[model samples]
Target: MQTEHSFTLVVAYVDDLLVTSSDSTVITILKTALNSAFTITDLGALKYFLGIEVSRSDFVQQLSQFLSEPRAPHWSAAVHVLRYLKGTINFGLFYPANSGLSLEAFSDADWGTCIDSTRSLTGYCVFMGNSLISWKTQK
Candidate 1:
């Protein structure tokens, strides 16, 4: 583990290594250290991880699009996902232990985000006692 960037975070039952900062330089340095300590498999960027399509938000409504792709076929996706998990085995989403306890959910729809189908995509998420338990978005 690198003294500079080695860290751990937990999201639900998943474990993730929280790299220091979002800076490319820091991430590079950390990746180097990680490679030295163990076999390294780079999934490139923080695009899709563990079935979740991550989108960074700037405000409550305005969300910046990062990347999104159709869910992989269950059978084949497992191998790829597993390899990704192994590579990022130490990384996870971290919620403060002292954070407030609550359960909430939100739903939204896009008029028509699917160019091929000309159909709208709808998505909703359920938070179990505050942490996201289930979510799905599809056209």
Candidate 2:
């Protein structure tokens, strides 16, 4: 194919993954690589990531999503997440042992961002040294 594209591996849960980026061609290339190396499926495009809203950004070269918005992904969205996993089953999250052990947190919220329930949402992420330790978004 001929197009602009990029790809990123978001997360891996067991045999599943969440892959994303702005390039359709890169996605296609990733899918081809995955199919060659393992059992695979291509759930084109990312509409959801980690239960948050996900869609292409206006720049046409990136993806964006909120941190606290609740969502129920449709079939394709779920499949996209799954395909992401298939493409990156070997990836791992590593916090280097020699890295600092200090703990730090960052948090912010948007009041009444949810139009459906008129409730504010909370979003937070914690880090240990230079590694992300935890994160959450709730309403």
TM-scores of all candidate predictions against the true structure: 0.34, 0.34
TM-score between model 1 and native: 0.34
- In model 1, how large is the Cα lDDT of residue 6? 43
- The lDDT values for all models are 0.61, 0.68
What tens digits encode model 2's per-residue C-alpha lDDT throughout 1-139? Answer: 3334443555676776676545655666777788899998656666754433465545212123422453555444656766998999998668898988788989999999799999999999988788886789999
Number of backbone collisions per candidate, in order? 6, 4
Q: Which ten residues in a row are the worst by lDDT in model 2?
A: 59-68
Worst 10 residues of 1 by lDDT: 59-68
Relative to the true structure, candidate 2 has a C-alpha RMSD (angstroms) of: 15.1
